[model samples]
Every structure is written in C-alpha cells, then in structure tokens.
Target: MKSRDFTKTGPVAMVAHACVLVVVVCLLGAAVSHAATDEADSPLTVYVAVGVLDVDEISSADQRFTINYFAQFRWVDSRLAHDGPGTIRRDITDITAPRFLILNQQKVWSSLLNVVDITPEGEAVFRQRLWGDFSQPLRLHDFPFDKHTFELPMVSFGGLEQQVIMAPDPQRSSLIADNLSVADWRILGYQTEVREIPLTNDVSVQGFVFSFEAERIFTHYVVKYIIPLFLIVMMSWVVFWIDPTEAGSQLSVAVTATLTLIAYHIALAGKLPDIPYLTRMDLFLFCSTLLVFVALVEVVLTSRLARSDRVELARQYDFYSRMVFPAAYLAAAAWALL
Candidate 1:
C-alpha cells in the first residue's frame, strides 16, 4: 500500500526539502550581512559643552553637591540619507539613538530644559540646562588642603563602546573655570577623556569623562576652625601658671578649659559625621583636646604633690611644663604641616 504512492510522494518530499534548505541559507546569509554592516558603521562622535551656572550646596559628610549647569550634545549621523534643498531642523523626537550624558553616581536631575537643532550635513544638536545633585568621592584625609577632579560622564542611550564615542567641544564649556560659581574652590581648569567603563566581563560601554580640576580654599577653615582652637589651647595654658597651693583655682581653670575644648570639638564635628578615620581637621582638634586634657591632669598631679608637702618638686614640674607643653604643641603642628 505504501509503495503504490511512492512516485507522487518522492518529488513532493524533495521539493519540500529544497525549500527548507533555501530558506535556511537565505537566513544565514542575511545574518552575516547584518553583522558586517554593523561592523562597517562608523562610530558616532558626540561633542559636549557644559556651562557652570550655580552651586546650590556642598556636603562633605554626604560626599555630594548640587549644581546648575548648561549642557550641549552635537553629533553627525552619516547613516541617515535625506535630500532636501536646505537643512531640516527638528526636535530631538525626530532623531534616533539620542546620545546624552548621565551622571556616574547617584543623582537627582530635574527641571531640564532642552533645544534641538539639525544641520544640512546631518549634524544634530541637543542642548539642555539642568540642576543636578551628584555624588562625588571625597579625600577628606587632607580635608581643606584637598584637591578634587569632579568628573561628569556622557554616554549614548543605545550605542555600545564600539558604536559611539565622545569628545569635549573645547570652544564651548572648556572655559568653565572662568564662570564657576563656588567661592570655596579655586578652579584649576578642565579636561576630557574617552573611557570604557565595564558593566560586566563581556560588556563595556564607551563614555566621555569631563573633569573639572579644583582645589579647596583653606582660608575659611583656618580662620573659622584652626585659629579659634589654637586660642583655646593657649587658654588652657593659663591654668598651668596658676599657684599650685590654690587647688580650687587651678582645678577650676583646668576643668573650665577642658570643657571649652570639648564644646568646640562637638560644635565643629556637628557639621561632619564621626568618620572612622581622622582628617586633617580631626588631627588639629585632637592635638588641642589632648593639650587641654593633659593640662587638667597636670593640675591634679601637682595639686596632690603640693598637698603631700612636696612643694619644691611641684614648682619644678610646673616650670618644666611651661617650656615643654608649648614646644611639644608647636612640634606637633609642624609635623602635621610637613
């Protein structure tokens, strides 16, 4: 029964197999062609411009700051083939694969106002003015003496590292140092670099890094924190000169100075978190606090000696401390500076 229909079935089966092979071959060829086209496509270059508008706030404790800036992105799409008598300018919605910069750290970017413009040579521009609260890494070990390179990176929305690249428009926001709004920092200049940040072992994205070089102005810290703390240290020294026979007055002065040092430290530390490591300011506060505590301890020891009728030894101890304490404090301060 099966042999009787072999003649009709043989040609039909061969034709069906032929069609399947042709379809598979066509699909494989199309895939190879698509990959080759992607490899041949030139990388889109995006030029970025940034303008420093204002600084809203800076928090060392949080390692973040909020600033207002104007940003622009310009690029050319050689792939789009359109023939017009002149340039056809349109909003960004008409463009595909809008490459924009995003903050590398946690940020809040809102209230952005943007404009789009296109040129006859396939050049497209997207400019935005926005305020962003951006996280930055802090090197507080140097505190007021620290220098920072604040980096902002721009990346494409849908392009890979091989598909897009970024460069700074030196003619535009390169002079951001001239118009920066923060007084506590002196702008050193700006620089841009191309970077491929790894998202995974097999995937990395291309990005443009914008660095604003700057250093903190230490005048405010010295005037507000250091000098006052130094005065308090000197104030504690006054207790050392008090008569050892008068235990009440010496103890009162020493205790009062120690309390004042504690108060100053508490107030100063209120602005920053109690980090596990010591900063330059912390080192200064530590020196001052130690001086005051040692002075108070000396008062107790000398007062006790005087009570034990060792008046000569107590006077000698006080005289030596007069020379030793200031020298030691000065030495510590110099060491810190060096």
Candidate 2:
C-alpha cells in the first residue's frame, strides 16, 4: 500500500523541525544573556574602616612605642553577583584578597617606609566578610600576613608608601584608582603619604605604617641593617694595629672582635626574615669575621716563625699588619660608601 508516503511529505516535516530547533536555541541564548547581565550589573560592595591606637612600649631604653591599628571590612552586598563554580565568589570565600595591605609603619629614616604589623584585629576585619576563605597553606614565596616589627634607628622622621590590592579577583569587581592597572581582576596602585600619628602617652611611635608591597619593607632593611652593618665591619678591621710578636694579645683582640660580629649577626638574624642567600648585612658580617680570623691566623703564624729561626719574617709581618690591614679596610669602606 503506497502507505500515505511519508517521504512525499519530507520537505514540510523538515521545515517544521528546523523552526522548533531555532526557537529553542533563541530561548536558551536569551536566558544566558539575561543571567550574564544580572551578574555584571550586580555590585559587590565591601566597606573598610580603620582605627589607630597604641599597643605597648617597644623598648624602654630606645623610647620606642608600638601602635596597633584596627581595620574592619563589612560585606554590604552579596546579591551584587551570582555564584558559579570557579568564580570569584568561590575563590574568595573569606572576602580577603591574597595580596597584602600596604600601611605606613616606618618611623626611623625619611627615605625608608614599609609595613610594621598585620594583627589579629586587621585579620578580623577581613574575616567578617562572608566571602572570606584563606584555607590554602601559604607557600614560602607567598605574601606574609602578620605583625611586621621594626627597630627604628636613631633618626625620627620617615614616610610610608603602601599599595593595596582592592580587588584581585578578575571575575568579581572593579577597582577605582587613578594610577591603577587592572588585569583579569588584579588592581595595582601605590599609596604614598607621610603619616605622623601621635601616641596617647607622648612616646614617639617607633613603627611606620604597614603595606602589602615588599619594596617598602626591604628599603628599611637596606638602610638600617645593611648599611650600618657594613660600616661596623669596616671598623672591626682596625684591629691590625697590635704587633704580631704580641701574638697572645693579638689573638685576644681578634677573638673578641670576631665574637662581637657574631653577636651582631645573631641580633640581625633575629630581626630579619630567614633566607638562605647572603643579604647585604650577611655579606658585611661575613667579611668582617673573615678579616678578624685572618688577623688571628697571621699572628699565630708570625709567633711560630719567631719561635723557630725566622725572627726577621715575624718583624716584617708586623709591618704589614700596621700598614696593609688599615689601608685595605679604609679602601673597602670608601668603596662601600661609593
């Protein structure tokens, strides 16, 4: 039976099928676009307020004061965006960015500025946000979020420059700053200002402002630890004055000088971040210790020669000790200054 041939009606059926497919595609496209628009227009608003207060005395002898500042972040709007897998909402469950907050904390040298502390008070500010999530373990190269302590030098005036990442998650929010760069969702800008917050007790605030950038922190290290340590090492090389024949006295002086340098290294290491490579301070300390050790070795060698048959050699050694050591040390100091 030429059954009512469906093949003869193929063109009409094909046209109807195509029309239905098009309508479904159009509806799906509209839904996705509407959802995207809603998310894009939604505003994720966070409010941050800061209060500065005194913490405690850093040191009695130095007349140094430690101050603490509290920062509070409140999540004002969670409906600003829709959450999806691998989205910003998922990434920043704690609302705090992985980057550091730059603060003004240096009080010693005018040209040096950096962060001083990242307290629980500050972390609490970030924790209050519903999006806060910092469950990942911090790697070595990861930015540190803790109290940054600084021993101010004798000087009193300094300024701090801090650059904080307002929004680092690209899929989340926009940042507002004139000199800022935005990529993906990271914002980079600098905050440069002179801060002078007076303590309640009239003690000078020994700490500078805090910030997220590393350059500001390392600048202080260069000026306070590296420069001063270099000078001290050069000064220690002056021990070459005692005669090699007075080997016992020379050894005593050298050992004492070396011990002093070791003490300095210990103090410096306690303050500075632990790193494997030689810092500027480390270089200076090592050089100073080596010079003292060399002087001790020379004294021992010259004394042994004098006990044997080389008294003249011992005398010559004393001559070099007077001239060569002083000259070399002076030259090194000059080079370092340059």
Candidate 3:
C-alpha cells in the first residue's frame, strides 16, 4: 500500500482544498459570536406598560374644577434590559417628570411632577400625584340640567408617537375614590383611554386621557335663580287682580314689576360667565321678561279703557290678558328647557 502526500498534490487540487477550509472557518465564526458589542445597541422604541389611576377627589364651580389625580406609569426598554442591564435595574434619578399638558396650567402641572423607578428589566415606574384646577368649555346652554364630558390628559412632552406608545391597563381603566365631594355637580363615573394628540411642530405624541361625565343637580339652580324669578313674575301678576278703575294703583304695580324684573335679569347675568350665545336659563329669563312687560302694558291699556268710560270692555280685556299671558309664558318655557 502506497500513502500519498498532500504536498505532492497538484496546484489546482491544493487551491480547492484551501478554499473549503476558508468556508468552514467563516461559517464557524458567524455561529460563535456577533461582531457588535452589547454597549453598541441603542433603544429605538419605549413601550409604556398598562397603568392605574387613583383619583383622590374632584370639585367644580361652573367652569373649572379642582382634581387630585394620581397615577402609576411603567415604561419598558426590553432591548436594554436583555443586554445592558443583566440582572440589576438602571436608575436615572431626576427631579422632573416626563410630560407637558394642553388642558392644565404649567404652574399647577409643574407641581404634579413625580418620582421614577427603574427595575432590573429596564422597566421604569413613574408615580404621579397632581392637584390642580382644570377648565372646560362648559356647554352651560343646558345648565342645571346639563351633562358634561371633561378630559384630563397627561401628554408626553417630547416623545413622538413612533418612539413611544402608551398602553392602557386592561385590569384598570380608571379608579375613582368613593365619596368624591362635588356639591352642586354630581360625580359620575369616568373612562380611561389612550390617545395621540397632534403637536404644533407637526408631530404627534401619546397620552392617557381620563374623561369624566357629570350631571348638574337641578334643585340648587331652581332654588337660587329660577324660583326667585318665578316669584317676581308672579308678583307682577298681582296687577291683574287689582281694580282696573284705579289707574294710579295699576301703574304703580306695573312699574314696580318692570323694575324688579330688570334688576333680577341683571343680577343673574352677573353670576354667569360672559358667554357669546344664549343659554337655557337666558331664554327662560327673556320669555319671562317679555311676559312681564306685556302684563304691564295690559294694565296700562285696561286702565285707559276704564277712564274712557268702557269699564266692562276693560274688565274683559284684562281677564283675557291674564290667561293669554300665562299660557304663552308656559309654552316659551317648554321650548327653552325641553
């Protein structure tokens, strides 16, 4: 048996052998390790874990309200957790919280800045406690019987929608404390949602919006403004019962009612915020004022008729005015309130 030496092999054969060796070595290198290091990896996206909100309290006075809002935020950097931080957590301790707002005041929201915690898995926890006055463009057109939906959004300041996303908690959408104190405004339940709002710079960002629906307790408004106005209008109606033969007495009552109604309307107007359009209350007041003025005119006309020696005609006209005036007032009220 003769053994062949590789050195004695032909040049072409040796070249082919070397090529096979090179291929095997390259494949092994790829299988064993990657060229890039762990530190070289950068995070492109941050996913916020589902969170819970604990609302402390809510109180409102017509336009704006005070809220003690608290929430917890969990942010995960999965890529960083797997590589940069193996078993231990990363901490970026700072005094500032991550957000800006469109609906709340900067001064008040600044105080809402909270603490952060980063776990071993690159999970950042943000604990927030905020107390501030939030304003809504109240559609008080249906005031006292109005239902309102108000939004409180915690918006991301610099994070773009592509870079960061907010995930609403499946377990908890909104958690409101029982016995929330709002005297005139009834505190109904709320809903939580994840939203993307457009920024001035043409980019959009993610946020958590908590919407609260509330109903105004009608009894208070009825007691404060509506009943008083009704009483005054009734006082004016007293002229209808007065003798048409006494012109001095009739004029005195009419003048007194007119002045009193004008004063009531002015005072009530002062209580409301300056709105450009008419409200349900405004329409009612208008109808009431018109009725009172018409009543005063009726007194004037009837007294004139009596002085002209048509006493029976004056009495009949006065009787019709009372019925027609009240009926029209009632109809106008239905149109406005209903």
Candidate 4:
C-alpha cells in the first residue's frame, strides 16, 4: 500500500482533528464549570449577635431554662445588590444566608417574621426574636453557692465549619440590664464567641455562642435552707447540755433531733436533681446528720453510765460533748462551703 497521507487534508485525518477539537472543548468547559462550583462553595462569613431580652426561668431539677432573646445576622452577598438609598425589606428566601439551629433547643417559639433587610451594596441584616427552653448541663457540685456560665450554641444547618463561619458582632450583642426574671442568680457578665462544635468524629460545624456568667444569689438558699439546717443541727446539740442523770429526757431530745433531721433531708431532696455526686449542701447535711447520730450514741452511752452509778463520769462525758459538737460543726461547714 502507498504510504497513506495522515495530514489534515485526508478524510481520516479530518475526522481525527474533529474529535480532538471536541475533546479540547469538553476539557475547557469542565474547567470553567469546576471554577464556578468552587466559587459557589467558598466559605461565607456571617457576623452574628445575640441579645438576651429576659431569662424567664432556670430549672435546676430539669437542667433546662426558658429564655427570651433576639439574634441578628449580617452578611454581604453581591447577588442581592439592588439600587436603593436605604435598606429595603426582602423575603428571607431571596437572600443567601446561613441557617442555623440551637443545638440544645428543647422547645421553641418563633416570631414568624421571616424577612431580611438589604442595603444598596447588598449588605443584609436579619433579626428574629425567639422564646424557648434550652437544655444544658448544670454543675451543681457547689449547689446553692454555685456560679455558672450558661452557653447557647447555634450551629449552621447542612454546612461544614469551613463553609459557614461565624464571627461575633460585639456592637449588637448584649444582655439586658433589667427583666432577667431569674430570682436565684445575679448576672456577672455576658459575651459572644465563635466556636467549632463537632457533630461527628470527622465533621465539625461553626457555632455562635452566647454565654453569660451568673452567681447564685445564695442568700435565698442560706435563709431558706441553711438557716433551718443550722437550727436543726443546734437542736441536736441540746442533749449535750442536758443532765445525763435524767436519762429519759436526754434520750427524748436526742431521738427527736435525729427524726427531725431525717425528715428535713427527705424534704430537701425535692429541691434539686438527685445527682450522683454530693453537693456542698449535701456534704454539709451529711456531716450534720452524722453529728446528730453521734449525739444519739453518746446519749445512750451516758444513760447507761448514769444507770450503772457512774454518775460523775456521765457528767464528765456531757461536759466534753458540749465543747466538741460545736467545734465539729464549724469545721465541717468550712470544709464543705469553702
């Protein structure tokens, strides 16, 4: 066969050129499409702020709280640009914005005003008021004397941390000075922070955190729980001063104090969650109960001594107990509270 000319002029060569042209065009188109996709998937930065309008209720037993608050979001999207001297209202769907859900939300009430404000330059602002119950772990180890930094974290929906990042907008973030409505805590301070929260071992999402520190307004606990506890503990001490010779009266006092402390412990159990770890109050109560029990044992021993005609020795035991019991209480209180 004559050496076939494979130059472009030949029919076979022309067909081959055409196929090469199509392949090159497909590669170029694919590259352009990939660039577009990359641009679309680039990270979006949203400035976020949260303001607490009121802290309605905090339930220690349930580890949940009800709060009223408003959140504001700001972002810029060129797709939303329009000619306007001032901000104009637009439907929320018209704007490209990050959507998020409170990670700990138990129940929620929405304001239902699904609208966003847009400026001529496409700066968008979205605000919403929310009322809800949110759950959080409360560290009650200190109990009535405990201070807590309550956290509310919002994580973007359907986006990874790299896709939607949150930055705190300090100018718009604040806690209300009044109307906190929480009776047992004094607000220390509040702040907003950007955090990354893991959803799985390999996945995490950006989060906006609004947190406030509050200290227990422990005066209520002191007056309502501690003072009564002190009185009950003091009542147990009465037997130490009682004449050991009157074994009957001494037994009566000790037995009554023991029973009352037991009843009080049962009543107080309803006030807080039955956590496995002991709280400061629990420790103090335990020490008080132990002291009462010791007094009960002493009463029996002294009564036996008095009956056995060791009356002088029984008085000596009473004398020592009167001094020892109060000292023991003070030491126990310091260890538990401080």
Model 2 Cα RMSD, 1 decimal: 17.8
Question: TM-scores of all models?
Answer: 0.80, 0.40, 0.75, 0.83
Q: Per-residue lDDT of 1-338 in model 4, one digit per residue for the tens?
A: 77866663778778888999999999999999988678577877788888888998888888888899888888777667888878899777655666778888889899858788999998888887889999978999999889888888887775233377788875665555565788887888888778787778998777888888888888987887788888888888898788888878888888888898888789788878879899999998899899999999999999999889998899999899889999999999999888
Stretches of candidate 2 off by over 4 Å are: 1-241, 330-338
- Please write out the lDDT profile of model 2 over residues 20-85, one tens digit for every residue: 999999999999999867744554333343332322232211322343434333332323233333
Flag regions of model 4 displaced more than 4 Å. 1-35, 82-96, 159-162, 170-173, 200-202
lDDT of 1 by residue, 67-156 (tens): 777778877765443576666656565556464756554665656544456666677777777676777777778876888777777677
The parts of candidate 1 lying over 4 Å away from their true place are 1-40, 79-94, 105-115, 159-162, 170-173, 177-179, 198-204
TM-score of 4: 0.83
- What's the C-alpha lDDT at position 315 in model 2? 76
* Backbone clashes in model 1, listed as residue pairs: none
Stretches off by above 4 angstroms in model 3 are 1-62, 78-102, 106-113, 159-162, 171-173, 198-204
Q: How many collisions per candidate?
A: 0, 27, 0, 0
Residue 45, model 3: lDDT of 30
What lDDT would candidate 3 get against the real structure? 0.66
Model 3 alpha-carbon miss at residue 214, Å = 0.4
Candidate RMSDs in Å, in order, are: 8.4, 17.8, 6.1, 6.5
On lDDT, who's better, 2 or 4?
4
The 0-to-1 C-alpha lDDT of every candidate, in the order given, reads 0.74, 0.43, 0.66, 0.84
**Tens digit of lDDT per residue, candidate 3, span 1-338?**
89989999999999999999999999888765453333224323323332223333333334666666666665555433444343443333332224434455332453443445555676666655666677666777886578888777666554322244555655344566666656666667677777876555787667767777878788977888888877877778778878799888888887887898888778776556877878888898888888888888888898899989998999998787778777787799889878
